[model samples]
Target: MTQIRSRPRSELFAAGVLVTATAILVAQFLTATPTAVVVGDESTRLGTVGWQFGLHDVVVIAVAACAVGASTTALLNGIGSSSATSADTTCSDTSTQESTDSTSSELLQARRQEWETVSERLASNEEQVYQAVLDADGVLPQSEIVNRTELSKATVSRTLDSLEAKNLVERKRRGMGNIVLLT
Candidate 1:
């Protein structure tokens, strides 16, 4: 099956701005009040109505301004932060990442098989947390393990500590996050 990917945020934001502007213009055209009023005097052919600010107009203007500002900010950030890369650079990075991912998956599969061998002796929560880590390429962040297993952070941490004591997994500090690795 072919996957349908979404456009970048800046593109979506710009499109939104355009669509909103078009809708506002169409609505104004369809429901516009007259800009001129005829007086009962013959001195003037037509007296142009003075400018009047309505709450609706003010609201619309504010919304449009906000949309435009957001769209422009997104576009500018995308442009300024983008760095040029040659095809060779991109292909090299992609190939490296693919190899790393393949190795990780292989390790994870082996870890799963090992877990299956001793899963009968494991408690339900421990098994669940272990399986979650095994599914994560043998290395995952503790927070991600919690999210995947649908367990509370405290529960995941305690289970991980227990697993570490049994030599089934290893937890190490990685920056501000804890990285769990299958042993």
Candidate 2:
């Protein structure tokens, strides 16, 4: 049996740097400060406000550059080491049809059968949770969602797992709790 592997730690680290850079950029934009320059005669002082790159801007730029560099490195490595495409047919067309066409509609219908199913199985709850996270526009704890939605920890965990399985959610380890994302 073959086992699939999760993403590499390097890629995850690159993604994390990217996220941090984005957040820093946002924070800089939100709280940018203008530098004041005094220009006048000796008797009087006039303060002229000028927009100069501050510490926040520098930090944002540095973080963004690191993110870009790491991402580029990861991409180059992935491309350079990729295996050649295989032409071998692993499954017959009949099996392919049975796997995709025959079950897709049923699964879709089942996903929409009820609210709980929609919340847990379908993308409805995932969408909601994702939107909520985006609306906050910052990293939020998983407990926030659990408390807000009145969902049990297990239910929230399962929903998160389902979301991750669907490539709609990602988790980042941050101290004790994982930071969630709607990828």
Candidate 3:
């Protein structure tokens, strides 16, 4: 005997609904006849061609409506079930979690404001140099900074010196060149 694997209830219900809808539509199609209506004066041989709906069309529309309703219900039910499960799983320590999330967001906002202030005080070249350091994993060799910023080594050195004076950057001697870091 072949063993059958059971699917999720929502999926199974959706599939069954879809199959039923398709079967009904197919049966309606098999029994349907092409229909048309003519309206106007027959004596003048002038008429307007118009379509006429039959029982088959009504059945098809009803099946399509049922299929749509079933799919929508399945989708909403799945979403609701998953959300409910997640809510139950994460219900513990809700207050602490909320506080921690808010605190982290606040810290992020403060850091963004601080950076904005510092950036406003920076010269164009200084900002470029700082960005280069930040892009280099928050610490970069002086040579790498020059390469990344595409600025002259002397300009990078001056910018670094200015940043260091402002306490926005730090430099450590690494071999013949210095490695720069954002403070």
Task: Please provide the root mean square deviation of candidate 1 (C-alpha atoms, Å).
Answer: 15.8
Worst 10 residues of 3 by lDDT: 79-88
RMSD of each: 15.8, 18.3, 20.5
Question: What is the TM-score of candidate 2?
Answer: 0.35
**1-183 per-residue lDDT for model 3 (tens digits):** 553444457677776776777777676656655454545666443444544558768867787778867776775565333342355457579896676667655765676567656777778999889777655545689999888889998998888877877778777676898878666
lDDT of 2 by residue, 1-183 (tens): 543437757667767766776676667667667766666666454564766777767877777777767776775565322221111134357777556545654654453343234345556666566555544542357878777667787877777876777665566666888777544
Cα-based lDDT at residue 31, candidate 3: 60
Clash numbers, per candidate:
0, 0, 0
Better of 2 and 3 by lDDT: 3
How would you encode candidate 1's per-residue C-alpha lDDT over 1-183 as one tens digit per residue? Answer: 553444446577686885787577456546645566756776554766655546787677667667767766666555323222222245457777677667655765776888767656788898888877777756689889988989899999888877876778777677998988776
Name the TM-score of candidate 1. Answer: 0.41
lDDT at residue 60 of model 2 (Cα atoms):
75
Clashing pairs in 2: none
Error of 1 at 41 (Å): 99
